[model samples]
Target: MKADVIDAEHASRVTKVDSLLPEIPVLNADDVQLVGDPELITVSVGDSAGSGLATCRSVPEDSPRSSWQALTEHRLELKLAGPEPVAAISALLDQWEVHLANVARKSDIETAAVIARPSRDTIGSAELLQHGFAPVVGIAVRPAERLATTGPVTTPGVRIRPAELGDLPTAVHLQLELQRYDAQFGMTTMRAGAEEMVTEELRAQLSGEPTMWIAELYGQPLGMVRVQLPDQAFWISSCVNAARVGYLSSLAVAEPARSSGVGTALANHAHQVLEEAGAEVMLLHHALASPQSTPFWYAQGYRPLWTFWQRRPAVR
Candidate 1:
């Protein structure tokens, strides 16, 4: 098929599928480049032709991509413009496998992933699982209206305070701890010079819009949470329908403070801040397999909006 005809078909199908899910917005096509020798792969669903597109992205270790982006060095992203039959989706996935074989070594791709709305999970789950992908992380969201009905999480003697320039050391330490814990689940990585990078990032964030907060017990820091207001969060906010969205960038409680409600207190504080700032929804990413975070975030009123199904080491 000609590239223009295929592109037109792919756009129509994508729009059709996206309109079905009011909660998940369509991904920007500009961010993904078309790949494969023929570029567009197609399969038949009954009488109509269904199409799929593949895009590969590489994030250098020093790339400006943030840590929350799943720290994988390279990614093979597969997109099927479907309200089509699962069989057609599966065929496209098969083509992706062949494409993976072609570029896995040369690109040094680390992971192959499909970012799917939770409502569509059953659509291509069988093929995704058979292709060695696991639902590794969830992009969870909490609506702003829910915040008004929720009360503060009270943990006596635990107080949340805004972070200042002087708090950089403690902030960086807690941030790295969060990264280290998530790394074990393979959703995040602590790269070389991570500390320095984190230090600089936090230093700037502390001085700016997405405020950082420190949780204290007996006047000593025990936990921290970073929240990006709507402006700073716009990049991720595009994925949701809300007019104003905020992000819970990072949150961590020290080992000694775990289960002591320090984490809950910090989260509640972030909720109040975003709600007061007029954010219509809050979003965050949590490791799917983490014993602590998965339940913690859900308990805090967030629900999985999207699931990132990923296969590590892209080819094998």
Candidate 2:
């Protein structure tokens, strides 16, 4: 007999399976087709160790119910599909788990949910501690728009300009200050020494790896932003079909400059530089749990495209 098939839509029926076997590996089976919708495909797990079947489904419209139901009393797995599959699967997994425990009186399986199309290599496992499903991180692509205003509005005595090799000392100081903030927020601090930071950043800048801008108030360096030229591979994959793109990395504003428009100024400069460099799109990553930075970036016109999920299975 042919293996069971699932589409992005019918994948909902397999929520029970997801709740039961959360850690089961999800393989992209783009080759198999489902019977109902030709646009959807069934992912096949051939002789897998897990004792369950999972499929993807598509939901054409926004409705409470969209032609998918769980099969109880059977070991199964399911994966949801949509523009935002991570969030949808998370909600469905929660409901399915609750219903199963309330009715079946048995709970032995570990269910896991992950956001597909992750931007990075691995979503650290720490993301699973506070929530059942890992939060889906977002990436935004900003379009180039002519600036109606002039350069950054700096403090009365503040200065802004491109960082030079001579600014390494000041840059290292600012980088360390940023590192302190990261440590306070339980983020991993860069183990590289100041010399390393300066060397790497300077090398990148000198080689035109990234456009670097610095903010100085009263002749004292305050903050920095680095706008990297678009990678050929990334451009071909994401925006090649549209327009040129760039990636913003290492945007930092000192604590004292938080509300002083320093961050916004640096970002605006980065955007301007990117636009002038023939980049029509820009992307950046932020920790979903980082309250201080997430909202700030959102206010600057970035939106969610994808998220990373993390979990650490108990070592045997």
Candidate 3:
């Protein structure tokens, strides 16, 4: 500031000076976002028809993810003819995390998950876990031919037989246990009126639609496992190539019968029964935690080709 005195010497005028502001760098879009060309496993990029059903979450439209190159969503697709699926593994995985986070944010999804099955070009199970996904369930497969070695071991006083229509009332009750067992592991949501819902479903399955096997200890219903030829693509299909797949859709043992080799016997019996009918492969899904399924299935020579990994996040 400068002051000038007039000849009258009674007043002074003051002049004020302003300083320039310092430069602040602004964030550009590239600087603020995830990597370019993220490998996205969505219906939008590749074959959108059958990416398979994601187990732990649903991907609705209007998700926050604005970028990605699509990957297979279902049924283990490996197409070498398309654009380069992955350029750099590390960069691609980083983008996977970003993609999951964005979808979680935008879709208001509680959990995000994906399925990894056998493929020549794929992020292997170990690598899949390394990128923040955890294996929650597994689909195990065994060739029907293997049943000869595991099967027909008759447990004294325990007989496995085909379920009759007369067994519907009791079997429906056991089916409730099956659904409750599934919900116990968070494999499925525990919906209201679930008992009523499953009662209706099991009734349909028992009415000649599925070959239900009931394990009995001298006419006592100890456990049950149902074997059916898959009518549709089960999302896992070395079995489909065999032209017939023996799918073990539901299995539940009574509280007193678990670990007594009843479930194992039933599985083997189911496998043997299916094999006789010319099924070339046997398949079943075991929740990693509930139904106490993992150890037993592995022991029965069923190795997992696909593992479902899930994690629940706070809703935004």
Highest TM-score scorer: 1
Give the distance in Å from residue 193's predicted Cα in candidate 3 to where it truly belongs.
2.2
**How do the predictions measure up, each by TM-score?**
0.83, 0.55, 0.64
Tell me how far candidate 1 lies from the true structure as C-alpha RMSD in angstroms.
Answer: 4.1
State each model's CA lDDT, in order: 0.71, 0.48, 0.51
Q: Report clash pairs, candidate 1.
A: none
Please name the candidate that would achieve the greatest lDDT relative to the true structure: 1
* Over 4 Å off, model 1: 1-38, 47-49, 64-84, 106-114, 117-120, 146-153
The better candidate by TM-score, 1 or 2, is: 1
Report the CA-based lDDT of candidate 3 relative to the real structure.
0.51
- Please give, for residues 180-274, the per-residue lDDT of candidate 3 as tens digits: 67655646554546566666656777776548888897778888887776553243344223456677877888888777878888887877877
Candidates sorted by lDDT, descending order?
Answer: 1, 3, 2
Model 2: lDDT of residue 289 = 69
Off by over 4 Å in 3: 1-89, 100-111, 119-127, 146-151, 230-241, 313-316
Q: Looking at candidate 3, what is the lDDT of residue 64?
A: 16
What would the per-residue lDDT of candidate 1 be over residues 1-316, giving only the tens digit for each residue?
3445545655455445444223325553333333333355666555334465555554556643435443332343333443464766677777767866766653333444554535334567877788877887778888876526656757899988888899899998898898899978767767778888898888888777548889998788989999988877877776776788999988999999899889999999998888888898899988989999999998998887777777766766
Superior candidate under TM-score, 2 versus 3: 3
Model with the higher lDDT, candidate 1 or 2: 1
